[model samples]
Target: MSDVSTPDPRQSRLFTASELLGYLVLAAVIFIVLPSVLDAFRLNLFGKYLSYAFVAIGLVLCWGVGGILSLGQGVFFGLGGYCMAMFLKLEASTPENTSIQSTPGIPDFMDWNQLTELPWWWVPFNSLTFTVVAIVVVPVILAFIIGFAMFTRRVGGVYFAIITQAIAAIATILIIGQQGFTGGVNGITDLRTLMGWDIRPDSAKTALYFVNGVLLFAVLFVAHMILKSKAGRLMIAIRDREDRVRFSGYNVANFKIFVFCAGAAFAAIGGAMFTLQVGFISPTLVGIVPSIYMVIFCAVGGRLSLLGAVYGALLVNWAQTTFSESFPELWLLAMGALFIAVVMAFPLGLAGLYDDYLKRHIDRLLAPVDRMMMRRAARKTSPKAPAPTAQAAE
Candidate 1:
C-alpha cells in the first residue's frame, strides 16, 4: 500500500511541496538572482515591472478563476498610485520648498493653476497613514460599488467588460481635465523624497525593489490561500456555470463582488508600489490602453497560475523596453502579433506550455534516476538474506 503520509501530487491540498518550491524559486529570483546580475537602474526597472505583476495576479483570480474580465483594472491601479503620489507630493511641497510660488504650501501644479490653497480632497493625503489606508480602501470601495451595481443586475460577460472600459476612459478624461488638481497630462513628477528620506539615490531604489519583492510575495501568499479555500472552488464553479451555481443556492453575485474587490485591492497595492519605485503616477497608466496591456500580461503569463502572471508581466515589459529602444515604431505591432500568437498557439500561456510539454519531458528524463534511487532504497531496507542464517553458520 502507498504510504499514507506521502501526498499524491494529484490530491488537492492547501499547499503542495512543488507549489512551495515554486514560491521559493520565485523568491530567490526576485530577491537574489535578479539583484545580483542587474545594475541598480535595471533592477529598478524590473521593480516597476513587478508592480504591474500585482495587477496580473489579480487578473488570475478575477478573470482566470472567477470569469470576471474587468477592463477598468487600471482605474484601481491609478487610484492607488494617485493616493501614494498625493502623499509624496504633499511631503515634497513644504512651504520652504515652494516659497517662490503664490501658494507656498500647495503642489507646484496647483500653484501654476493659480490655486491659492490646497484642495480639501488633497488635504487628507497629506497624512501618510491616511494615504496608505486609502491606497487599498479606495480601490476596494470603488470595486465593491461597481460589482454590486453590475453583478446584482446579472450584468456580466461582454457588457461588463465594455462598462469597465468606459469607466477607465472616463477616469482618464477626468484626471486630464482637472489639470490643477491632478498635475494634468504632465503627471505628478519631480518627486524627490518620501517621509523625509531621499529616494533619488540608487541605494534607496535598490532597497525599494526588495521591499516591492517582499510585498509581492505577501500578496502571492494571500492569493495562494484564497485559491486553496472553498471560496476559490465556488468561484470556479460560478465562472464555469453561473446559472447552475445560482440554482445550487449559492449567492453568485456575492462571490463575484468579493473576488472583484479583492482584485481591485491587489491592483491598488501594485499601483502604490509603482508610484513608490517609479516616483510618478500618470493618467496614461490609467487609460484603456494600459488596462488592455495588463490583461494581455495575464493572458501571456497563464492567468490560471499566479507565478505565471508575474513572469508574464516581467517578460512582456522587458520585451517592450528592449524592442522600443531599437524599433520603437514596430513595438506596438510586435506586441499585438505576440498576443495573437500566444492566444492561438497556446491558450493556457507559459504555464500551460510547461505543463503540456516541458514538465512531462523533464519527468521522463528523470525517471531512470528516480527508479535507480528507489531500487537502492529498497535493497537497503530489505532483510539482506537473513544474515546467512544462524543455523547454516554452524
Candidate 2:
C-alpha cells in the first residue's frame, strides 16, 4: 500500500524548496553581488532605489492583493521619512553643533525662518527610540483612522482614491506653510550624521544598502506570512466578490483596516530607510505625484508578486533616472507611453505575463530533469524497489 501518512502537497506548496532558493538568490544579488560590482555613486543610487522598493512592497500588499489603491501611500512614506529627518536634524542642531546659527538649539531652517524655540511637536523626536517607533506608528494610526472611517461607511473606489490624493495635496501645503517646523518649501536638508557615524562616506552607503535589502526581505517575508493566512484568502475573496465576503460573516472593514495599517507600517519603515540612505527627505517626495508614480511600480512589477514589486520599483526608477538624465524633455512623453502600454497590454503587470507564458515553458524545460530526480528519490524511499531496481536496470 502507498504511504498513508504522506503530507498534503497543499500544505507546503506556497514555498517549495526551489521557490525558497529563488528568494535566496535574489537576496545574494542585492546584498552580495550588486555592491561588489557597482561604483560608490551608482551603488548609492541603487540603495536609494531600494528604499523606494520598500514603498513598492507595501503597494503590493495594499493595492495589489487587497484591491485597495492608495493614491497617497506617499503620505505614510513621508511620515516615516520626516520622523527620521526630525531625529537627525535634532542631532545636528545641538547648541554647540549649530553655534553659528542665530538660534543654536533648533534646526538651521528654523533659524532662517526666524523661529526662536523648538516646536512642541518636534521635541519628542529627540529620542531615537521614539523617532523609530513614530516612523511606523504614526503612519499606522493615520491609516487605521482612514481605513476605519471609509471602509465602515463603504466609501470606496475612485472616491477613496480622490480623498487620498487630497490628503497628499493638503499635507504638501501644510509642510510648505509651516516653514519653521517642517523646513518649508526646501523641506529638510544639510543632515550631517547619524549617531556620530558619518553617513556621507562611501563605506556607510554600502552598509546601508545591505541593511535596506535585508529589511526589505524581512518585510516581504512578513507580508507573505500574512497573505498565507485566512485573512489573506479573505482579502482575495473581497477583491473578487465583496458581497460574497460580507455575506460570509467576516468584518470586511476590520480586514481592510488591518491590511491598510500593515501597508502603512511597511511604507513608513521604507521612508525611514530612505532618509537614512539618501541623507535628506523633502516634501516633494511625499506629494501626490510621487505617490502615483509609486503605484506604477506595483502595477508594472505585477501587483500580485511581492518579488516583482521590488524589481518593478528598481526597474522603473532606474529607467526614470536614465531617461531623464539622457533624454530630458522626452522622458515624460516616454513614461506616458510606457504607462499606457502596460495598462493596455499587461493588465496584470509583468508577473502576469510571466505566469501566462514563460512559467509554463520553464516548467516544460525542467520537467524531464525533475522527473528523473523525483524517481531517484522515490526509488530510495520505496521498500521493495531495491531488488526491482537492479532488474529494471538490467
Instruction: List the global CA lDDT of all models.
Output: 0.90, 0.85
lDDT of 1 by residue, 76-177 (tens): 999999999999999999999999998798999999998889989999998889999999999999999999999999999999999999999999999999
What RMSD does each model have against the real structure? Answer: 8.0, 6.3
Q: What TM-score does candidate 1 reach? A: 0.90
Query: What's the residue-level lDDT of 130 in candidate 2?
Result: 92
lDDT of 2: 0.85
Model 1: lDDT to the true structure:
0.90
* Model 2: worst 10 consecutive residues (lDDT sum): 4-13
List candidate 2 segments past 4 Å from native: 1-6, 12-14, 361-394
State TM-scores per candidate.
0.90, 0.90
